[model samples]
Target: MSKSKNESNGGITAYSVKTKTKNVPMIDPVIDIKSGRYIATGKDSEGNKMAAILGKAKAEEHIKNGDAKKGTGWD
Candidate 1:
């Protein structure tokens, strides 16, 4: 058996409403801040867009460590 997309890409898991799938791995994940809340957004394997809310500190860490891209309006 082969590794799943998430395992192969080490992507963050996010719920995908479009695919109706839970724990879907996010592709090209980006971190952004909105209304003082941290958000993680990316695409699923099927190319469906997904997003997950994260904590402020955790999001900042990902940005600072270069684990995720800083999305628009993120400073």
Candidate 2:
């Protein structure tokens, strides 16, 4: 079986403000467009909310490829 994009990329990572950590792996990430910007939101190991800003092209590509779910009420 082929590995999915997220798997190949080692999954999504976000900086954890609460934990004061960098490159923290995100769980159950979802991509959303907020105020004309692309953003990814999920949880950390301790179930703390985490979010990361993503590039426009990258976000659009992920959405188009069905690798990410379109989030509602993200704005």
Candidate 3:
């Protein structure tokens, strides 16, 4: 990205992120496996439900350790 004039002068400017914020659903999603649907359940430190594959246990542990919340809030 090209630097703005203010940036060149050491002045910081706020810019919006280029991606939309995605809200993870609270309910554990049911994935359609060949045998049946698998339901996932877990929460982040802030209590935000995290049911995505590949880090549920570790993320939940982090949440309990301080990286997340409890109940139903977002981090």
lDDT against the true structure, per candidate, is: 0.71, 0.73, 0.32
lDDT of 2 at 27: 78
Collision count for each candidate, in order: 0, 0, 8
Across residues 1-75, which tens digit of lDDT does each residue of candidate 1 receive?
A: 754322223445777887777778777789877888778888887888888887776667666766678887665
TM-score of each model, paired residue for residue: 0.72, 0.71, 0.23
Model 2 residue 54 CA deviation (Å) reads 0.5
lDDT of 2 by residue, 1-75 (tens): 764333336466777899998778777779878788778888988999988787777676666766566796343
What's model 3's TM-score?
Answer: 0.23
Per-model root-mean-square deviation over C-alphas: 5.5, 5.1, 14.5
Q: RMSD in Å for candidate 2, one decimal?
A: 5.1
Q: By the lDDT metric, which is better: model 1 or model 2?
A: 2
